[model samples]
Target: MTGTTLTTADLDPHRRRILFRAWHRGIREMDLILGQFADTELKTLEGEELAEFERVLGEDDNDLFKWVSGEKPLPEHLKTPLFERILAFRPEEAFKPVV
Candidate 1:
């Protein structure tokens, strides 16, 4: 009772499908974003830069969702807009549902 809630079953079929699609899209986007980083950019990162990137990637999926949805404030050092831009990429328009 003290832990996180499990509410996946509460979601309607269409909404659940949308959530699944978004989650998959987000994962793919993260990969592409990381790929865009040059060796120099990654190598040049030190101290806080490296730590922030590590922390962001280390977060669990639920926390990651909260962070992306703006429901939770990202750690100050890890709040780089660059990472957000990378993770927000939409490679496949087919996955994008009409709103």
Candidate 2:
């Protein structure tokens, strides 16, 4: 998917906003990473997981990029299941060589 294919029609205002932010980070790499993750997981995330996701979205895109790309060690504060899920999420299109 070029970006989020998931509809936000069922999401609450907060979740909808988060989904939008995920697909529109300053950098395209981050946008794909988090946006795809949100598309797959945001609807099921609940309570603290959802809150943690929101907190992660607020982090700097460059830092998030480094962490997700494994270019930098993830800090203790950022160690969470949601972060791990993000690190593991890979949009097939995002990693393909552009022809």
Candidate 3:
């Protein structure tokens, strides 16, 4: 899909904003990674997890992409379980061969 299928109608303000940001990250790679993660996980995230997600979203897309893709190691401060979740949350479309 070109964009999120998750509806924001029932989401809290925080989640709505976070979802939008996740989908609109500067890079399409990051957008797909984070946006798909948010689409599946945002509704279930509790307050702390939401906070962690927001914090992770604040990182530079270049560094976040490297960290997520394993091209570079996660910095000490970013080596949290949430980041691990992000590392594992690969949407099937992300791996599809480009045409």
Residue runs of model 2 more than 4 Å from their true location after superposition: 96-99
Q: Each prediction's TM-score against the native?
A: 0.37, 0.89, 0.89
lDDT of 3 at 42: 95
- Could you give candidate 2's per-residue lDDT for residues 2-95 as a string of tens digits? 4688987899999999899888898887788888889899999999999899899899999987877778999998998778778778666666
Distance from true location, Cα of 13 in model 3, Å = 1.2
Q: How many steric clashes does model 3 contain?
A: 0
lDDT of 1 by residue, 1-99 (tens): 211122447655643443333334345433323333321134444576655555555556565645655578876755586456534642343235457
lDDT, model 2, position 1: 46
- Better by lDDT, candidate 2 or 1: 2
lDDT (10s digit) by residue, model 3, range 3-94: 99899899989899999999999888888999999999999999788899998889999998888778998899887788788888877676
> Where is the poorest 10-residue window by lDDT in model 2?
90-99
Top-scoring candidate (TM-score):
3
- lDDT (CA) for every model shown? 0.45, 0.85, 0.87
> Per-residue lDDT for 62 in model 2?
90
